[model samples]
Target: MSLRARAATTLVLVAAVLGLGLAIAVHHDPAAGADNATLRWFLDHRTPWATHLATALSTVFAPMWVAIAAVVVSVGLIRRDQILDRGMRVLGTVAIAGALAEVFKLAINRLRPPTIDQIGSPEAAASFPSGHVTGTAALLLAAALTVTASRAARTTAITTASLLSAAVAVSRLYLGAHWLTDVVASIAVAVAAVIAAPVVVDAVLAALRPHLPLRLRSMVDVGGRTSVEAAR
Candidate 1:
């Protein structure tokens, strides 16, 4: 994609992300149900085992100070497999972007639902955007990018990613850790990040392309999967 095209794509995505972020923030009605019955199904299976797993997976929303380790570990592992390069890009963007969502939350200092009223108050702290949703979204995107081992694998990847991300969002509400807006914003942030990553990666990859040996550059290019997407 041309630089102008890339810039336009990024602008569109950033605008959408920021727009969705604002929408979720302003629409923070405590009484309203943003709950999706589908996602709450996971909580039904919420055994101690599930909670343990959920707790661990949920840390993608960890404070920036703590997520560094996971990011490092994740990148290190993915780097060995050249095919996994996309995953590293996805996770790295997710880590940085997810942290930003948290920072927004902390700055907004939005109150959790329960504190405002039994039904909850729109009493927001800086919590307009949710980090959990953001992190989960990034992770979901990474899975979508990587887990195409087969038709089954692809199906599993999309379903699991959606469920996990949605479930995590729901958990935040159930735990009263965040307002509904926080969860919604997190999704918006994640989608924004997803839309942002490819365009940036393509540019960086293209620039680094010439310096790398021809053999390596060919491998790096990944057969033009992103060229079309980036242009759009």
Candidate 2:
């Protein structure tokens, strides 16, 4: 692998190790007093307008909605940039991150915060990782990675993504839907997915090229070349 790919692999491995440790820690102490304390603090400190904003952010940034937005964004990238690989990276990152959050939720099966309003919150049953934040983070990170045209644009994109992700994560806590640990774990997992997306999506496209229709094979061929370059 190239130095960039190797660096990304190292980061992914590190995230996996830390995530495993967190899962073990959370399993032993689901309440995670400090985490719950932070969640409660956010709830306690919220103003009416702040609460409304938090609720809106949490609802709007739900995993399903974010996934839908990702699809739209990916289509736009493909159509405008004429780069299938870039679009696939964006979609794949969000999908992979969302899947990781779900798997962790199932494996941990950790209960949501006691103060959480079960009604209208579909993912309130299990909450070791915040699915909304995971999807949001992945979508924004993928955008930052693939959509920028210059160094200044890249910086702006990264800044916007970081701020939006932080807001979404805090919204989950403020709404009493998740503990601090849940959002933190979701961000970590999302980071791993974003870092891996370029290589992973390209590799998958390359593998699928032969199976695609003749007209579509050429589109997949572009991604295959990217896969080879990424692996160099």
Candidate 3:
């Protein structure tokens, strides 16, 4: 099968799994574990650890990563290097996916676990999807696409990004700030961003590449010599 077909299949599988999980959660008593012994034990013994971990994940999911991406693109533009600028095209997909995430969050409005012991509860939001996870997924996807040079590198970046994103979501649960569903929602947001960005970026860059200056036109042959013409 073609690469596109394979990717589509994978996405379908993921959606199916997510759907099954949601069905089960919806049918079950998600809130029955408020007084679970394991959670209480952790709250009693590892409060500090949970707090620290959550805080750290929060930082990773901050807007700072987006700002950094803009900077990277800008720098690439200034240098007349086209690669980074090309990645900007993908950023739009990220934005749309993020917006979708918020919409879903609002619609689901699932409550956070009461006994999770976090800073705030999702009073009117779905706990199944996580906004932080979404943001992290978006940022990581954009970054990974921007630097897609190797299979190992892409795998590593995705892995790292996933771990960090998951950590943030887990932290929310550990801190009692959110439920597992909330974290999952956030991850859905992020995953959608990544999944959509590449296709969008490809179309955009293809349309724009023709307008780039000669100096940065060749990413594959970036080292090709070019003579600058003197200003008239």
Ranking by lDDT: 2, 1, 3
Clash pairs (backbone) in predicted model 1? 108-125, 108-126, 109-125, 109-126, 110-124, 110-125, 110-126, 110-127, 111-124, 111-125
lDDT of 1 by residue, 99-180 (tens): 6676666545544554532112343446557666777667666547555457898888777877877887765655445656
- Please give, for residues 78-165, the per-residue lDDT of candidate 2 as tens digits: 6665446677889999988888778777877777877444223545478768888889999998989774457999989988998999
Instruction: Score every model by TM-score.
Output: 0.62, 0.81, 0.65
Indicate which candidate wins on lDDT: 2
- For candidate 2, what is the lDDT? 0.76
Model 2 TM-score, all chains together: 0.81
For model 3, residues 161-223, the per-residue Cα lDDT tens digits are 777666766665566655554555456556555665556655666677689766544344344
Runs of candidate 2 with Cα error greater than 4 angstroms are 1-27, 116-123, 210-232
lDDT over C-alpha atoms for residue 147 of model 2: 46
Q: What is the lDDT of every predicted structure here?
A: 0.57, 0.76, 0.56
Model 1 alpha-carbon drift over 4 Å, by segment: 1-17, 20-78, 99-109, 114-125, 210-232
Better of 1 and 2 by lDDT: 2
Model 3 residue 72 lDDT?
A: 63
CA lDDT for candidate 1 = 0.57
What does the lDDT read for residue 34 in candidate 3? 43
